[model samples]
Target: MKIIRVGEPGLERPVVVDDAGTSFDLTTLTADIDGAFLAADGIATIRRALAEGRLPTVDVSGLRQGAPVVRPHAVWCIGMNYAAHAAESGAEPPTVPVLFFKTPNTVVGPYDDVLIPRGAEKTDWEVELAVVIGRRARYLDSPADAARHIAGYTISNDVSERAFQLESSGGQWSKGKCAETFNPLGPALVPADELDAGNLRLWSRVNGEPRQDSSTADLIFSVDYLVWHLSQVAVLEPGDIINTGTPQGVALSKRFPYLRPGDVVELGIDGIGSQRQRLRPA
Candidate 1:
């Protein structure tokens, strides 16, 4: 099942996209797609509803797509998790996963306009596969346990501002990562059972030129390991999002020009779908 949230921001209605690409309103089953719903076996419940033929189909032609899940409990990011990306940034691959956070407010619909923060000059883009947590996880026994806690997957553009991230902020990457609209997420949330998180092709393009083209197979820390690793320190709650990390070929690599107002960016992971964002001045 491909779950989605549709409508204007702050007023999105839960919906599910069928195999035929038709959308059905899910409000009759749940109010919003959030932590409480996932924690309560929401997906199972939705399946039951579908089997009973109780869900109402809706016309999504003119509605805007919101982030598939509502604001997660937290938005955690893995830094330098891709070997080539780490190499591009001139850092050795870490023996452990490097972590960071993008505040919840930074999340917006996948197609929303991304704002270049005021006075910002080193803004950048990253294409990452984001994991949505389905169960509360703390001190998991092993990476194998990680799969049961995953709800689904989606695409994210981990937009960054290089100067704030590296040069002026004393090495805190979140400083550059927490700007409004910095995280553009979702066209739909493909359930864990429906997609394989590993071995998927992911890519990003600025305007019409390709910049990053890589695979999740290149992740230094696999999704299972990341979930298990993070659970040992912080409690992983349902609806929490973990950005698995981006691949090589970002403006930060100095191989491409930084984004400016009027530039359009597009990115996607195979099967999950694609998203496009227009750069706009703050």
Candidate 2:
């Protein structure tokens, strides 16, 4: 099922796109799509109803879409996970997974405007694959076991500011990552069970020109392994999001090209959905 949140930011309602492509509001069952529903077995109940044909359907055309998950506990990220992206940034593949976090306040709807933070002259774009955790996890044994804990997938633009990330405070990456409105997630949240996690393709464009284009096949740490590894360090709570990192082709990797007001950014992944945003001066 294609799960999504719809309506205005902070006031969104849970919804699912039914078999006929009509939107069936899940508001009657839940208020917002978040960690609680996953932990409470709401997903399983939805699946059973869908199988039994007891859910109602409505017109999909008029409703606006919101980020699939609301109020995620944290937005976790992995850096330089793609070999080519690593090479492009003048770095070698890391011996261990590189992790970072984006404050939950940075979350915004998929099609919302992305701000160019004040004094940010080097704003950049990164098209990334975001994984949503479905249940509490700790000390998982292997990738296969880790996979079962994923609730779904969504498209995310891991927008970055190069100078703040690489030059400021010597080496603190969060200063560059925690900007408000930095992460635009969800045209829809696709349940992990419905799609092929290993083979999905991803690509990004800035103002109608192609930039980053790569596949999940290039990830240095597969989704399952990262989850397994993270669970060992801290309890993996439901509603926490993991941004698996971006592929090469960002402005930082290029000798020229940085975002300015009015620039448009777009990206998509197969089976997940696509999103486009207009860059505006802050």
**Best by TM-score, which number?**
1
lDDT of each: 0.93, 0.86
Give the count of colliding residue pairs in each prediction.
0, 0
List runs of model 2 lying over 4 Å from the truth. none
Instruction: Quantify how close model 1 is to the true structure by its C-alpha RMSD in Å.
Output: 0.8
Residue-level lDDT of model 1, residues 1-282, one tens digit each, is 789999999999999988887778899888999999998989888888877888988998978999999999899999999999999999999999999999999999999999999989999999999999999999999999999999999999999999888888887889999999999999889888888788999998899999999999999999999999999999999999999999999998888999999999999999999999999999
**For model 1, the run of ten residues with the poorest summed lDDT:** 16-25
Q: After superposition, how far is residue 241 of candidate 2 from its true place, in Å?
A: 0.4
Provide the TM-score for each candidate, comma-separated.
Answer: 0.99, 0.96
lDDT of 2 by residue, 50-112 (tens): 777677875556666778899799898999999988998999999889998899988888889
Task: Tell me the lDDT of candidate 2.
Answer: 0.86
